[model samples]
Target: MGMHDNSRCINCEWAVAGTGQKFCPNCGQPTPVHRIDWHFLGHELEHSVLHMDRGILYSLKQLMLRPGVLLRDYIEGRRGNQVKPLLLITMMSAAVVLLNKLVSGGSLIDGGAHQAIATGQAVPEQLQQFMLASRTVGEWISGHFAAFTLMLLPFEALTFWLVFRRFSRLNYPEWLVISTLLTVQTFVIWLLLIPLHRWLPYAQSLAGLMGMVYGAASLMQFFATRPLLSTLWRTAVALGVFSVTSTVLVLVATIVVTWRA
Candidate 1:
């Protein structure tokens, strides 16, 4: 049968057929050999790809040029031309997490001893020890994410209260928008720190550095807009308290996981 025939659909590279039926059975849509019918794909792929292409590039340019400006613009309702903040955050987070896994030697499901033993066969004992000792990339990432929302929600609430207290007219939804921006910023730091962690092998020390960087960034954001000595002092206090709390929680969680295993 020729490529155009339904029987050839399964053999056709473009047609992704499954089950016993032929002729691109998946999605019940006719498969185009050379070109896909735009309407058949529901136009979702086109829309999604276009938005992502434009949104990601635009967001990146803005973020690189003006770190805080994107958040401010988003909060002020200049949203249509740019990507959604949460979507941008999610994409960046996934990319960073994947890169971290690649650099750190793969996923948590890969299993530490198995990977070490498999890879250690030709490698030196010292190198094997190092790989074995390192936390599974999955665990490290999971730990960060699991703690992120819990840790930052309260910090964001406190920040909104301290910084925007006089703007009582701003509703809770407005505070939520601010909080979402802050959360996105935290993920941005993760995008940065993942590479840093690969270069710096001291996990605990790196964790401390990450916490400090996050706190400092938050403090800077607060200070930039508020510009009051009292607000600076309050931000510092709040940040220190949250930093210590987040660190302790992370440590306890890590210890528990280790002890359980």
Candidate 2:
């Protein structure tokens, strides 16, 4: 403990006691010199304890080992030691997309452009020219896919929140938190499976299916809190809503992009 004679709160500059005082009474900040010695690694040890729980590895481990339980705890006001949902998802999605670019050296969504050209079904000259001239746009889309996900996430969360309305009266933001974490988990799966796509051929599809199952399980476990059949039906309804909403958004975006091109 810091000495009362020389001890002070770093944050509020208030005096603190030297003996048996773990924290400052005035500012609530932990005392820095808790029986410190020149050779002892107290600062490092304190940092390790305070920061280890907030690391990406800790969040990933929780997501992988007990995603439903983690979400439940987080939603039920037990968030002291857990990662923030938005930050965790953002980091996961960024890591997934960056690693994907490193491994493939191409845009993941470029397959759609390739397929359109390959069809050769009386393609319009302007459309073909636009497509050819849109490599930069495609790269931008690839790099910003995570941003797109975040933008569309509120609508996705709405689907579940609407379908499972009876289970919880919380507003959209609460559901958005759940959706973000689930989406991040999907990105994790995508990162793991993208490299295997060449050999497995259907690896991406498998990952997508796993993501859907994981999302459904999370919803059912965290929100539904009902019988298996009832929870499954609610999950199906949410998925249906998400699918229709995504399709409409994609069509609209495609039209806008093509028009602008």
Candidate 3:
């Protein structure tokens, strides 16, 4: 019944020139065999929905349910089933910014600035001024969290590459992939904890600790052939490098803002 079916091409109104011909010679469109009026629309909608769910939700499920296996599969060239790490991070960043705004009325950065302004003893005049300005600047950064992350990710990836160079066989680009995926995982933790941290500031520290633990586990899985202790120490070094990198980024951004002001 497959090849025997005959139909015209919708694009060019060409007649069914031959049986079993999938595309029209005149228009290069698929032969509309036994298709309803809404068949093309239905097909496109189904494909879009399927692709979105398969990549996004399925990857998230894998990361949550079996992260080691997920990282292993992705790094080992079984990534067709997974979403792009950068895209995942981009989507999560938007969610995180919105959640922060709703929960804290700004961001953790802004909140910290406010707390420092209110409670700090012997704060220098310049420090106080910077914190005051940081409220606005931090809110802007939080609102554009995706852009902030995009800028920060390269440094984070570089730190990972340098720290793990001796321990893992992965090159810089592969290290970037690991950095992206782990950052996406950490963002997921932030999404859960950021809102809670509004009412309970301790949740922020808890989130950081959780992210560190998750990063270590991801490193071990990613360098599955490496010794366990080697993976742990490399993860520790990576964390230290990443912390310094991120702190520098924040400081640089703050200086830029202050300079502009």
Candidate 4:
């Protein structure tokens, strides 16, 4: 048929050049393009794993070098290269929990100690026994960890609100920076508790005081951007709120654990 003829292949709207062709060249109809046997699953897995690893490394680097920079970047829409904040916190918390369990010699709450106490037997006068009587050391630490993290969320929101009160535009970014700082602080607390406990076995009161001090100091890092008076005031309020909230949360966690047991 002529190039301009209307009788051309209707499917492709191509001029019929010959009669022997099985399919239209323009549209490739009747004989479609064959699907290639590409290893799509393998490629997807590889890409996903590579991206996850890269994100983790990027998060770790920011955490180590700049402390609160990840939250700031993430809140500013610069999240493509790093792990998500919640995921980063969870992964680090899980690792810390595992390590603490390993070092503490067993579950923070020793079932054996609990059983002995239940049976009205004389318990050994040791750290583990005290943990059993009070709560497992691991359980105590875990409860505190959970309480500490949860308590930070509101304090973080408040700190950001106060610190960037003038910069209305950067409020959320500031909050995120506070969150990241707290997450890093939690990781640090877990790391430090091991050595502190080992060195001062009979110093539970000292340990509690140190914990409060460190918690206050960690939070002060965020308020450092403000004037000295503002920093002190905000830090004091935040610390008070954090302490009260954390104490309540840990108490509830302990009650629940005891009830369940």
Instruction: Report the C-alpha lDDT of model 4 over 86-165, residue by residue, as the tens digit.
Output: 66676666666677567664443224435566677775566334445346434556556555455556655665466546
Model 4, global lDDT: 0.55
**Candidate 3 local lDDT, 1-261, one digit each (tens):** 233235667677788777678888897887745445488677765654355546677787778667878878877899877878888888888877778768776455536665866675668888776776677667777667788778877787787778777766667777777777777877788879876764767654566678889989876766667699988987898788888777776777677777777
lDDT of 2 by residue, 3-56 (tens): 644367777888776756788888778776444575456655544334567556
- Cα error, residue 4 of model 4, in Å, equals 42
What lDDT does model 3 reach? 0.74
Structure candidate 1, residue pairs in collision: none
Candidate 1 residue runs with Cα over 4 Å from true position:
1-54, 106-155, 158-173, 189-198, 202-225, 228-231, 251-261
Residue pairs whose backbone atoms clash in candidate 2? 1-34, 1-35
Candidate 1: tens digits of C-alpha lDDT, residues 31-147: 444344567475655454455535566666655545556656666787776767556656755665576667675452224443647764676765554444445433664546534
What lDDT score belongs to each candidate, Candidate 1 first?
0.54, 0.73, 0.74, 0.55
Error of 3 at 64 (Å): 2.4
Between prediction 1 and prediction 3, which has the larger lDDT?
Answer: 3
Q: Which ten residues in a row have the lowest lDDT in candidate 4?
A: 28-37
Write down the TM-score of every candidate: 0.52, 0.78, 0.76, 0.51
RMSD of each: 11.3, 4.9, 5.7, 11.9
Which rank order by lDDT, best down to worst?
A: 3, 2, 4, 1
